[model samples]
Target: MTEAQRQIFVFMIYALIMVNFSGSSHGGAVSSEEEADRITSLPGQPKVYFQQFSGYVTVNKAVGRALFYWLTESAHSPLSKPLVVWLNGGPGCSSVAYGASEEIGPFRINKTASGLYLNKFSWNTEANLLFLETPAGVGFSYSNRSSDLFDTGDRRTAKESLEFLIQWLDRFPRYKGREVYLTGESYAGHYVPQLANEIMAYNANSKHRIALKGIMVGNAVTDNYYDNLGTVTYWWSHAMISDKTYRQLINTCDFKRQKESDECESLYSYAMDQEFGNIDQYNIYAPPCNNSDGSTFTRRNMRLPHRSHRIFRQISGYDPCTEKYAETYYNRPDVQKALHANKTRIPYKWTACSEVLNRNWNDTDVSILPIYRKMIAGGLRVWVFSGDVDSVVPVTATRYSLAQLKLTTKIPWYPWYVKKQVGGWTEVYEGLTFATVRGAGHEVPLFKPRAALMLFKSFLRGQPLPKS
Candidate 1:
């Protein structure tokens, strides 16, 4: 038999043996089926005061598609805190890896991936955090129908996510009417607003409405034209690319068109490959992650920077190889057993982002500004933030995008503080708020956890960032 056929046969045999454990793992009695998802404790985990749960919610029964979620309740008052749903956007990134493990989630995996340490500035202190691995094929989420993995788009993903939320509410009914916020970054610039639109539409006719209060997206991709233009400009301004390359990018690339010309693609390649050095484009100042052999790998070689959900972790200083730690931890058989993940014995390793979905992402709205307008008009609190150092989706791109809104300014731009030091800058518009984290990168919380936490707190309170 051919090696390919032999591997298929082995996978089939393993799948049959794993059938008994295929469904969501749950055994001991509890208040609800969600008890099945309650993570009593993770292996090598430190003692924690908050409750945690990780499990799958079947969003599509016909396709047998399920989305995985990890909920970390607030450390203080779990019952009274708001629920914040976080998604990391690669079109196919695992929020469990980025949002839950590296950024806002309470624990950080160690270098060996054998133990966990607490993130002192975890967002769970401000809200009950739920990190979702969405669109069926990312992370632990999967579909019995293989085609579902190849055919996912914004519309279907938003619909399935809405369905997941509704069913998840059924599993944990206590959070039915709780205050909620939709949050994400990067390609989730599409996921967050689109899902918010779906929820708003659902609430229009249904008696049971999700109490969604606000939404906050950081370093988000809102408009293709502005994002592309701003990215090229950022590259030039940051001295990453030559003046000649910048001029070529502006003259050759048609930012308005969804598909760039071959000439444009070539120029982009030249700028990135030839001019840009072995530095992290996500954070220009941060050192690039080195391979296990201690050789350097540029962000482009590892993964596309802005387009993918690759992220970094910081405790005292940033660890460039932190994403590797998540890959190591989640791929472990015992760790998967602990988190109740990978029950079907899927024939693949866990990656931070899925190249398949990234390549096959069916429909992307050229601009999400219309949805932003609608949300603003509807009086939902909206904040668009950026990390100043993130060249991938820089502060300038966000500013250019928001300029199109042209809302009257409520608060003029000014520095905001976290302990007498400048945390970032903020400017509140009539309906929307725009903020910038001082030295943060694409993932704000991972770079500036305390400032990100302060931003989250202010967002929750519907107040402006502190000017003191």
Candidate 2:
């Protein structure tokens, strides 16, 4: 062949190679970077039909801070599904350990950490699930600047998370302008609303706005005064504590203050240690994880450090040792390699919650109600749900906090059904909806998987909970 002909043939071959390299190995539309992040399969994970991607997204270049994320696309019609961002809050919890592994994502790590099993009620059936380990100190997400861990607070966390999302979307530009919902539990009540507020602010300035449609938080921490009062009431009403202890908790504990007084601290310690002994505070009725030595990791328990001595507690329909399983599984060298995590090899074991960051979380808004009011008025779908059996951030606390909103009732309180059973009760107000999952714990999905999945489906469709 002539030189000209040979050159033309070489160009054609290069173009073909480029096409093959740019597209996903599995023939889906994905960037080379995305393909690199894709998990062919996790260690001992059950054979799954859907695709999974996980890795880090750098949020702050100056500090070398990066956040880890796991994307579990829907098992069916993934491209057509909307995106749901799930955050599990300890103000320092790893969403991967709690949300992705236990609550909403498709897989549940076996007790032995030997293999994985499919969760029949995983939320990914209805939406693309993205679990993020936010800020700089939690899970595999880390920072070169150790001070970042100590200086962590609501403001910085929100800012960094917004940065993470913006950069993450750029990395997976396919999701730009897609319907997005922010959902979480516990302290995520704070993280969800704060992040939503930031997203709104970002949209106002940027041309490529995030399509943030709604937010759903469960057993969340809302108003401080109301939460404190309501928690005491719940303890008394549920018979968790005696009448005399309840009165002392009510009178001595300064609910209005951000920091508890010495007397208040003593009273709380008394109630927890003396009265409520060795119980799973996250789930009032559920058995504690068999491996647990009585310490629980939670936001409410964060304050009372005496009672909350450790991290990685577990509960629910499945074996109670799941957290231990996750701890063992994620820390495995092979598991980390498969996930593309711990690339920096930071010097710390992977715990479900970060003790350092949880203790040092600097600023917290006493009330998230203002953000709720703003989002509600902004025409965003806002839903606050509670697990009735959770004592930490109980149903009563959620009720009291929401009652302060004074939203007009759009739908009266009613029982919502799932599989012809009374799954939960729900009330739709003018701008918000409040629901309680019957017998669910702090981690709603872990305790009531069917009901939580149904709740999620209804939320995504912007439909009311099934009345029948």
Candidate 3:
């Protein structure tokens, strides 16, 4: 590349770094009841109020440029708060879907119901919460150029996310010197660390000062090599796979062996054949909704209760209340308007995260891992949590990803207690911690709101989950 071109590239990257951070906007979009206005701010989304103060941060507008909208909220205390930029993992999922709606956010959507519910515990109470619909293609955030998809990879994604932070800080100048943390789960395992590392690097190079602290990932897709293996192991351990099937996969499904087949066309075919036939990963939980495909396949997304993925069938939920809510809400136009989800339109159809990206695409794993390691080594508090029950990117898969890290255990394994009772499991290696939500499935916040909130709160404080 020419020198001018390289400089341009760097300049654009620098702009990207600072683009998504904008300050407060007109708050009227989310209306409220006359009395509720005293409490809630956002309406469609259950305005679960955090104790902290709130505001909006904007990026470049979507009208022309690739950089679209950015949203930010901070704890309104004079003392700076640790900032966590939260991303949800769907290769195409919305961060607001899980991080805001279900997990640590102050608000939650009612169980299969259209309306919002209050979460007594919200992660934002402890730290400033930042949620994003990154990569433009995901949520309200959009890119005018389709070619932007070419930027898909660990490195670029992280770089832009970091830039978003710098820009966010620039707008909310008050947070300029605050300790910043990056946290997310699922595919974000790759996103959070990569971005956190870039911020660390940027702070070092820039004449201007930037304070970056730590990172946390819950059920992130960290390591590719062992992730698949760990997933299979989880299925086998949970009795989802039979012994013969496990042994067969164990004998053939090897990452090293698969890597050697780089030039061989049949290599991936053989590995996949060995993989897909084993117990369905989604077998961990029943299909959450239909697969959006045919019945022949277990839903590729989170499993629901009764539906098959193939037919896109709606499962007869076992929870009578949830079932009634689902039935009633599905028929209600106002409720459908509230969820405002992806894929399905006003008539909200309950579905798992569908195949939203190109099948054969790019991965910047090599570049991304170094950044993750840097964040970890730099004493950035990192946390990875997951519901053991999620079949898609199962908790076992997360465990397998972490096992590849080889980080020494800083905190020994123990049941994370919640409400004076053991809620689930937690462990720490060096500064990175991992936790499991016992009965919770794919969406931890929706299924295990309290535990998820506790997990988020602990991350904000850079402490372990409080023992119940």
Q: Among these predicted structures, which one has the highest lDDT?
A: 2
Query: Residue 262 CA error for candidate 2 (Å)?
Result: 1.1
lDDT by residue for model 2 (246-340), tens: 98878777788877778777777787778887777778788765535655433223542111223223344455667778889999999999999
Estimated TM-score per prediction?
0.90, 0.91, 0.69
Give Cα distance to truth, residue 243, candidate 3, Å: 2.3
| Cα RMSD, each candidate | 10.4, 7.6, 12.1
* TM-score (C-alpha, index-matched) for candidate 3: 0.69
Query: Candidate 1: misplaced stretches above 4 Å?
Result: 1-31, 298-317
Ranking by TM-score: 2, 1, 3
Question: Clashes in model 2: which pairs?
Answer: none
Question: Per-model C-alpha lDDT, please?
Answer: 0.84, 0.85, 0.54
Please tell me which model should have the higher TM-score, number 2 or number 3. Answer: 2
Write the number of the candidate with greater lDDT, choosing between 1 and 2. 2
Clashing pairs in 1: none
